[model samples]
Target chain A: MSRVRVHNFSVSLDGYGTGEGQSMEAPFGHAGERLHSWFFETRTFHQMQGRPGGGTGADDALASAWGPGIGAEIMGRNKFGPQRGPWQDEEWKGWWGPDPVFRTPVFVLTHHPRPSVEMAGGTTFHFVDATPQEVLRMAREAAGDRDVRIGGGPSTIRQFLAADLIDHLHVVLVPIVLGRGERLWDGLEELEARFPSVESVTTPSGVTHLTFARP
Target chain B: MSRVRVHNFSVSLDGYGTGEGQSMEAPFGHAGERLHSWFFETRTFHQMQGRPGGGTGADDALASAWGPGIGAEIMGRNKFGPQRGPWQDEEWKGWWGPDPVFRTPVFVLTHHPRPSVEMAGGTTFHFVDATPQEVLRMAREAAGDRDVRIGGGPSTIRQFLAADLIDHLHVVLVPIVLGRGERLWDGLEELEARFPSVESVTTPSGVTHLTFARP
Candidate 1:
């Protein structure tokens, strides 16, 4: 089945998912950069940046699992950038420069619509203005046998989680606390019922790994 | 074995663990309240708050796992409260009230030294002015066989994480974007090397249950 998964999401101990007052310079925002210290140094991340001779380790192993068979991706407009309303200029790309990390068909859930953006790599950004269900249908169709990964900024993932559309999730619990900022799961539990099982691993590099699956 | 563990810490996705401004109203500073949504409504949380009847699903299960079996806790002065400088008032308990959640001996890492505070519950607040290692020794002795939980605002967890002292951590990836706020992990990857493998679950309630343990 084409399951929807949230992989390698980073969070703070104080509970906020993203930091406050994110600017163009600090897209993740103030302390937000601290969340992914584990993944950024991984061999997989180095490889993605086109660096050679960098490969496998515990961190690399986990990083290597990031995006492979993920046929499509779902993200909020914020993850793409801070621009609201309509996509005025075509010059705005993601924080990752030209070629983004997700090299698949990326579906961005936005209130505004724009033409598809084809990058140098296999990535093609698609803007969808419908409900989460409509976005999921399109993503699933684009995904095929592969999984559909939800790229975050928090709100996007919360919508999918609220609808029970995600199948599994992988979170990297960095040992820092954002005393303030955006949260990952705000009022989600207040909305409905839930059942989830979790398993975990702690690595030597100060990163703890966790997986959540439905029983 | 008294392994170091980072517990109940929250951070912003932008890399900030806490905001710059410190005040009672903005406890965590600006949007800081968003980080702790997960722990507030869980069955374990309710049990701690002396309440009854909460969602008993995986999210609740994860919530219950956060506050049990820790012999000691370490926190920064910022986490202890917005009160700075010296010990002015004897009646300044934490924001959690007289009977705090952590019923064990709590160590506050700070430059200022204050006498231990014996609360209504089994919780005792001990202020330490020495280094993190010094505090760790005290907490370890206090913890015995149980894990030594590093409880903090952000800088505290970062210091511990950089020292490679944390063994297990569970960072709940809440789904909200601050756009601007404190970040969790900013520049610590060069000091440590680990990737997180995750265990996760999505409750119909919208909160995703994620677990991470250091191996």
Candidate 2:
């Protein structure tokens, strides 16, 4: 069955999915690339950048799962770009150049909706203003036989989690304490009960990979 | 050299040390015993209650290190009891009953300073309003040749961590999410940089033990 999975979602030790002060320059804010440094070092991530010979250990194994089996993605507006409020102009395609990594029917949740734009590598950006459930219904339809991925900016993930829609979640606990940022676990009371099968594995990079899956 | 260490500090997957709504009845608030259920199963914790024959594995080994080689403990006012603000009366010794743990000088950080109350088993509760450095100075002096422990209620630990006083920290990541509570990692920006030697171990109880030691 197709599932709603969150893969390679990195959070600080303090449960912050991203750091504060997210801008066009600093997409992850002061957290910068520290939260995703582990992923950057992985062989899978290197392959995405058209680079060869990266670490092929546990980190790569998990990083490699991001694209496979994912038909569509539901991402917050922040993940698409740092442009908040109404779009200043449609010129801001995304943080990624013409060829974005998603390469799927990516639904961007925003208050100000816009027309869908198709990018290179089979990636299409669809803007919608709706609740998580409503957007998820659309994403599920777009996903069809494949699974829908909840690409997050913390608040987005929290909403889906609060709605009990996520079936599989892969969270990487980065060693750094972000101190102040958008926290992902807010209002997720008694989260352990929802996911019975939880496993943790520590890679050589000193980050713990926690996977929570519903039975 | 005597060290300042934190052992067996339990936190939820969301990085909450304890849940919200802490009162006299709920020492750990709504978190209850869920955060510490793993420790309770350990032989060291069972032995604390005068019980016997508990598991002697990794969890037990880590739990057993709570007391030995520690001469003094510096804890936040919340950890002692749920009585916030000024001391209503000097009668509340602690929640640990007559035979409380920590057979040494235990300094409780509180604005309303009360006279020292010596409890059973050589545990002396000394209330004082001082900074982490000031309290640590007194604890180190009282400890003599032994080490001091920075006992916590999240906020207290964050203070010590901000001051860069703690040399060793052992944080257990419980798989639960309290949603609302006092977080331990607040204001501790880029904490991983301070602790160079970090390690993680997953036990049978489905909790990952993360140890960070300053070089």
Candidate 3:
């Protein structure tokens, strides 16, 4: 079955997905790279950098799981870049270079929609000012037989979680206190009840991979 | 030199140390036994019940670690009982019958200080309206050479954390989402900076024991 999954979504011990004061230079704001330090040590992350020789550990194993079975992704506008409100001009393509990490059609949720931008490689950014359901429908269509992924910046994932749209959620619980930032678990109290199957694996790198999947 | 330590402090994935709507029936509020189910499976909890055998896993080892090398305990009024504001009467000794978990002296943090009550076994309850520092002084006196444990109910832990009174913190991260409850990490931003050392171990019971210690 084609399931909607969220993979390798990192959060601090305090539950903040990203830190305060996010900007172009700091996509994750004050959180810096602390939330994703574990990811950086993974082979998948090394491969993303077009480099080699990264840690082949439990973290790498869990992190690399995101690529398989995923066909398309849906991310918030902020995830595409640090730009907010009306697209300041079409100058900013995205945080990714010519070729992005996701080699599939990606739907960018925004209040103010813009023309679709096709980049190098298989990645193409489609802007949509739609609800989680509508965006998911478009992503699922683009996904075809494969599964759709909710590539988050916290709020986007929360919307899907609140709507009970996600089938598999892989949260990488990083051991840090971000203090202030976007919280992933707000409003959706007892979201675990929706996903009966829960599992946790703490790697030696000090990150706990917590997975909640619907049976 | 004796240190102020906190051990076996269980919290939901959403950072709630205790659940909402706490009463005599539901001490952990709506969270109920979901948070402490891992503890029940531990050998320590079994020993407390005078049972012979229990799961001798990482959960058991970590849960049992709470008692050792500790003397006097300082807990929030809520952790002791559900009674709030001024005490109705001294009839409520505690949730534990004759002998409570803490064999050492236990100090209850409250605005309304009451006369000390000595119970069966070595456990003694002393109600104090003093600040964290003042209480620490009294607890140190009571503890003598042994360490002092910061027994918590989220708000009390937060108060001690805010005051930088806790030296070592061992938090049992239970895999549950208590949407609304007392948040332990609130206002204590970047607390990991104070504790230079951090380690995590996830048990098969889907609980992660996160320990933060000072260098």
Over 4 Å off, model 3: none
In candidate 3, how many Å is residue B171 off?
0.3
Q: Report per-candidate DockQ.
A: 0.06, 0.71, 0.83
TM-score, one value per model: 0.54, 0.93, 0.98
Which is better, 2 or 3, measured by DockQ? 3
In order, the Cα lDDT scores of the candidates are: 0.71, 0.89, 0.91
lDDT of each residue in B1-215, candidate 1, tens digit only: 76777654554334445555779788867655676666676677788778997668766776666566788999888888888887677578787888898888999987888788899888999988877888898998988888788877777887877666777765555444344545555445323235254454445444444445556
List all candidate RMSDs to the true structure.
10.6, 2.0, 1.1
Q: In candidate 1 chain B, what residue range of length 10 has the lowest lDDT sum?
A: B186-195
Q: Please tell me which predicted candidate would have the highest DockQ against the true structure.
A: 3
Better of 2 and 3 by TM-score: 3
lDDT for model 2 = 0.89
Of 1 and 3, the candidate ahead on DockQ is 3
lDDT of 3 by residue, A14-76 (tens): 899999988988999999999998899889999998989899989999899888988999999
Question: At residue B67, what lDDT does model 1 achieve?
Answer: 64
Q: Where does candidate 2 stray beyond 4 Å?
A: B85-91
Q: Rank the candidates by DockQ, best first.
A: 3, 2, 1
TM-score of chain B of 1: 0.86
